[model samples]
Target: MIDSHIHADTRPFEDFELMAVSGIEGALTCAHDPLEMTSFDVVMAHFRRLLTVDPERAARNGLKLHIALGIHPRAIPHDPERVIEKLPDLLRNPSVVAVGEVGLESGSEIEMDVFKVQLKVADELGYPVIVHTPRRRKAEITSQIMDLIDGTMDESMVVIEHVNRDVLPELVETECMLGLTVQPEKLTPEGAVEILREYGTDRFVLNSDMSSAPSDPLSVPRTVQRMKMEGFSRRDIRQVSDGNIRDLLKISQI
Candidate 1:
């Protein structure tokens, strides 16, 4: 099973060891808002360390790992040009799968500016993106991003994440992939199952969004179990758990 969007860099090493034992086959480890309070060099250094440690740890423990590098919207006072300048070189890493955790956190002008630049860069590089929708008024935030990306980017190449029931209609209107984060106080296992039942699993992926807050790493696995209990067939489960992301990962060139 793959937790498609996770801040693996934020978790302790033992947490990954636990994930390995829990049948989590792989994860896309995303860099959080390092630029929010840290220097660019510091952020880059952390990413560099994660790119090295995560894959090695995963490989040694029989788990697969991938990376997504970007300046998160929550990171303020960021130089979009600096990130754009460094992105090309970073994308060259074979383990890096996408450019993301990028999008509007506040739907502010600065956030939108950086989001637009990354969207353009990802489009130019032919890489898939993992977008972060705002916690408040996610529909509005997602709509804002779609508007920004209207002409310059392809919706199909993006994963608009942290979505929920309120934002479903807005997301369904686009060709982009939908991510359901199974974090506590967010989307529950039952809620995700209902979404799959109601909407079908096409262009959908599941994640635990682990290590961000008080959460459960087993959330994805638990969600899968509940889906099974709810009479979703193995093939249906596979589609959300692995197949959708497997297709997305193909764009990585890893």
Candidate 2:
């Protein structure tokens, strides 16, 4: 299991064959705000279909897709620095990892100057970022996205996704990486296992931001069968449904 946020190009290839028959091997699929960003070649043809047509339609319906390109502060276009100078040659595409569904929905000022220029281009290309936090003044826009990711980048390479429980006690004492997005309007596989039993699964990551709204493509294998009917360990449900997002996107094992 690894859904650390999904879109699979707005769902439907039978929901990646029902999220690979409900055991969901892998997924990432980020880059958002597409109902026309309107230029920079329509956001570089939607980041070249999330690097070539949504990883060949999630590997022909057996899942294992992964990619994360940026620009999603409500899909800002009209020359977002030419898609931030073409995101380091398409994030050195080896099925691109992160820079993500970037941050701040309406903390405007050009969405905080395009989320501080894509978090300074994912901290000058070291990569790993997925920061989206908005559902109307979510803890004051996540404290202005943790003050533009305080001192810029390396809050353990960022991940602050669609979290809840009113910003989980200030993002569980930040060092980033916490996504918990089960969707329906977010957070409800028993409120993402009650924020992993009151925020214990350190650096939590579990997702199904499966877009085109009203989602639940087997929301991370039905929240891993509700963390196995709430008895929770199996190494804490394999570290939030797959080893803290495959060790925060260093994803090696296929």
Candidate 3:
């Protein structure tokens, strides 16, 4: 199964072991908070290293790892263009899949500006994007993004992550795929099943989002198990567990 949205770079060795045992065939490791590092060159270097190191690490554990290269909104640099300037070169690398984990967090003007700029870049380059919606005022933030990308960005090329109950209806109105983070404190395995039951698995995909959270690496596989127990058919479960992610990766060419 493919976990569509995982910060595998932030995950540990044991987590990889757990993922392998839990039947995770592949995962997309996204660029997350870079902590104290501030230089664009320095940040780009770190992401480049990730492009190299993560695949080798995943191969050793018998897993396939793909990369998504973009500055997270909270970690957007003082000069976001400096990072945006480097995306084309990064996208040329075969391992790099999408442009994202980029979007508004505080819903601040600066955040929206940077997010729109990156969205333009992704649209220009013909790469899919993985957007991070705000934890608070999610509906407002999503609306803001939709407005910014209304003409330039294609909804089919975006995956809105960290989605929950309140924002699902509005987000589904767009053609973008929906990502649910299966964390202990957030959406449980049962909760994810309930969503699948209500929405079916067509535009829906499941993720662990285990980075810095109280979520387990095997959450996706566990969710699959729970869905089966809850009477989701194999074909339907595969749509949510693997098919939807595989289709998105194909669109991103990674």
Candidate 4:
């Protein structure tokens, strides 16, 4: 199984071992704003960690780590154009899979402008994107995000993350995939299973969204176990836990 979204740089090395031992084969670590104040140099340094430090650490612990680079909404630097210009070249790296963990946080004008610029970059590069929806004003902001994605790029190339039941219906009709995050303050294992049953497993993918905050590194495997207890078929389990994300990111099975 692959964790579709995670901030591996924020996790302890032991967590990777636990995830690997729990049957998680790979994970995609996305760039996020971890500090109170972010600068262009800081963002570039974080990207370097995602590319160089994090992958090697995960590999040593037995998990294959993939990277997704972008300026997260909350992490937007003073001069975003510099970061945007660097993305095309940075995204060409073999380990980087998408432009992600980017989208509306406060829904400010600057946030929207930066989000659109990153979306355009991803669209032109033909890379998948992992968009974020905040806990507060989720419905309203997600609606705006959907609107931005409508004609801007291929909806199929985007996966909106941290989605809950309230916003699930809005995304169902769209071509983008739904990211069901199982973690503290997000969906529980039981809730995730319930969603799979109601929504079916075609366009859904499971993730832990593990990061500096409280999270469960083995959330995906634990969710799989819940699905089994509920009598979900093996194929259905594979589709959500592994296949859907692999198909979206074009990652190989480990």
Predicted structure with the largest lDDT when compared to the true one: 4
Error of 1 at 208 (Å): 0.8
Misplaced by over 4 Å in model 2 are 1-4, 7-22, 25-28, 32-39, 55-57, 64-71, 80-106, 112-131, 134-138, 142-161, 168-179, 182-191, 196-226, 229-254
Backbone clash total for model 1 is: 0
Worst 10 residues of 3 by lDDT: 245-254
Query: Candidate 2, 34: how far from true, in Å?
Result: 14
- In model 1, what are the clashing residue pairs, if there are any? none
Q: Residues 153-244, candidate 1, lDDT per residue (tens digit)?
A: 88888888988988888789889899999988898999899999999988789998886586777777888999988898898898898888
lDDT of 2: 0.85
Question: Which residue runs does candidate 1 get wrong by more than 4 Å?
Answer: 251-254
lDDT measured at residue 74 in model 3 versus the true structure, 0 to 100: 80
TM for candidate 2 is 0.36
Query: How high is the lDDT of residue 70 in model 2?
Result: 86
On a 0 to 100 scale, what is the lDDT of residue 90 in model 4?
A: 98
Model 3 C-alpha lDDT per residue in residues 84-189, reported as the tens digit of each score: 8878888888888888788878878888888888888889888888988877888888888778778879989899998888888887788998998888878898
Ten residues in sequence with the least summed lDDT for candidate 2: 194-203
lDDT of 2 by residue, 1-254 (tens): 88888878888788888888888888899988867796788888888888888788888887888889888888888788888887888898788989888898888898888888888888988888998988888999899989988998889889899888888898788788888898887678888888788777868888888888899888877887888998988898888888888888889766
User: What TM-score, computed on C-alpha atoms, does each candidate reach?
Assistant: 0.93, 0.36, 0.95, 0.98
Error of 2 at 194 (Å): 2.7
Model 3 alpha-carbon drift over 4 Å, by segment: 251-254
Candidate 2: how many backbone clashes? Answer: 0
